[model samples]
Target: MEYNLEVINLTKNYQDFHLQQINIKLPKGKIIGLIGENGSGKTTTIKSILNLMTYDKGNIKIFGKDSRNLTKQEREKIGVVLDDSFFSPILNVNDINKLMKDFYSNWNEKFYYETIKKFKIPDNKPLKEFSSGMKMKIKVLCAIAHEPKLLILDEPTNGLDPIFRYEIVELFNNFVSNGENSILMTTHITSDLEHLADEVIFINDGNIILDVLKDKIDSEYGIVELLENNFNNIKKEDYLKCLKYKNEWYILVNPKYEFQKKYPKLKVRKPNLEELMLLLVKGE
Candidate 1:
């Protein structure tokens, strides 16, 4: 039951936005997918975890040590891939390799080069000249070159093609196969989470709204579409959330099997991650 990262009562406030007391736990050897709409505080939470920004109140623990007090050696055990952070675009593969060698004591140059060759990334091209997908691949490679135990990534698959995204997903699967490493990633692509994540945390308006196992999302949660009259017939206590679309209504119900038993013809079905988020965020 060891956790790789824990956020306890984390809170940050701004003039127009507030990240309320947030709590998250990333267990070792698991992939936790953080999901939310744009400007919903996904990036803010990540920045706070990385100590890139200060929070008003909370405790963040990484590897059981206060994140703020992590030693240089301890910091090296974590890899980070931020959507807007990277080495200067002018730097090429060799330059980055040279810089990383000085930055991390365990930099794996051989493995880095092998990965570069496997991905067909040019060794001499500047990052500025690479496409978004290429740049993303390089960033991921750089993050893992140091052989870290935990990876924190923001929007790692934002602009990749299906083929590349599949490859990256496979790479992530391989990363945790050893049962010692873990990854925390944020992406708008919930489908990827359906295939890769062990747990999913949904954040909205700077607050965590739902945290559950990926399997439970399918096995225990259900979605029902019906007309307003039929929707009103269902007891409020039986469903978690509901949304209205013109003449139709969608309800998110837990323990769908029971709901199905009650309304046998209601067409209750499991929700995909995206549908679940939509109902949670926009449903009343």
Candidate 2:
């Protein structure tokens, strides 16, 4: 299988934080959701992959080319939507369009206008005047207007209302329908990942804790509340993670069916992305 992006033993350090020995494999034609709390190195990993910052160790490859060595043309094949990066807020839709046209040889003018009109974004209004949701919509539009093969987004749906979020999700669905494009989006909004992501990578404190298919999460992974005595009956390797609240224990168990067959009495329920993150990140 071909991968769109690969990070091998990537590491970066700061006075208080360290992105330690991170490895990721993002396959083509899939949406991989990166989930973590603030200061968990999601943005740091994305920045390193884009070569926006230097890493102390490891390698990053995009579209089979070394990320640091990507040519201008190779770099153009990736679209990026950073939470805190964009054209000047004083620039309007038209100004951005004009700038992107000159910057990207593959910029699609027709698609740009079509997306703007479809989203009812004013072509003449400055980005500073737009609401947060509208501003995010514009950012997404700019990222995809060039029709890149890979889209990397950080918190793209952070402040959007449900309606706008739904529209943006639909647009993402359409973008990847061709089966050649892929997206790596990091968001605190796990509800979107619950529905859209093919797989999820959960990062906490600079380490990747969980990497699993969304389908398996829905079908085979589950959480069970067990008493201390019952919890002791299960082996550490049998479950992914465990948390204790009061006298009850919440354990994240994979292959829920097998677990159920073994216990036959405990109730195992499927976990949403947020619950899974809490269990692994905060649990023992």
Candidate 3:
């Protein structure tokens, strides 16, 4: 399958932190969830892909062309929404519309206006007057109005209520329906990824720990709740991670290994992405 974006052995080092040997691919028309804890290098990886930060090694390709080689015209096909607001605090929505119109060659005034109205963002209200959720909506609107082929979003759901978060997830679903658009969303909210992500890349401490299809994860990893007494019998090497809550111990095991047969009394169940991520990151 052709990829919209690919990162090959990417590495970036900072004074105190480093993004080491990161490899990721964003397949065309798919929404990839980049799951990681804070300071896990998600933003650093995104910046390296966009060439916003210099990497010590490796290559990033967008549309099969090296990202570093892409000219302004080529780069325009990608849209980005970071954690912070890029628009000036003093600028109102009207000012932003005019500013972006001059910035992007393919900027669509009609779409921008329609989105602002659909999101209920007041055209005359200054950015500083808008709530965090409203500002995030504006950022999303600006990114989509230009009709970019690939979008890179960093914590787009931050500060959003549950209702609006669902709305944003639906918006992303609609965006990728065009069949030419792809999204790489880095977010801590794993619940948002349950229904939306086709693929998930787990990052921890600047390194990718797991990269797998969402469906495969659901089918493979089982959460086995064993009695405290039985925990000592379970082989620690066989499980990916384990946690103990009071008298019961919850273990994440590969279902292919026949964990149920070995521990018949253990309550084996499927785990969601969030639980799996917590286990991977916290070693529990």
Ranking by TM-score, best first?
A: 1, 3, 2
Give the root-mean-square deviation of each candidate in angstroms. 1.4, 2.1, 1.6
Which tens-of-lDDT digit does each residue in 168-240 have in candidate 3?
9999999999787899999998899998999999999899999988888888888877787778888887788
Residue lDDT tens for model 1, 144-263: 999999999999997788898899999999998888899999999999998899999999999999999999988999999999889889999889999998899999999999998888
In model 3, how large is the Cα lDDT of residue 34? 96
How accurate locally, in lDDT, is each candidate? Answer: 0.93, 0.91, 0.87
The CA root-mean-square deviation of candidate 3, after full C-alpha superposition on the true structure, stands at: 1.6
Ranking by lDDT: 1, 2, 3
**Of candidates 2 and 1, the better by TM-score:** 1
Residue 227 lDDT in candidate 1: 93
- Which prediction has the highest TM-score against the true structure? 1
C-alpha positional error of residue 17 in candidate 2 after TM-score superposition, expressed in Å: 1.4
Model 3 clash count equals 0
Error of model 3, residue 10, in angstroms: 0.3
Judging by lDDT, tell me the better candidate of 1 and 3. Answer: 1
Question: Where does the lowest 10-residue lDDT sum fall in candidate 2?
Answer: 171-180
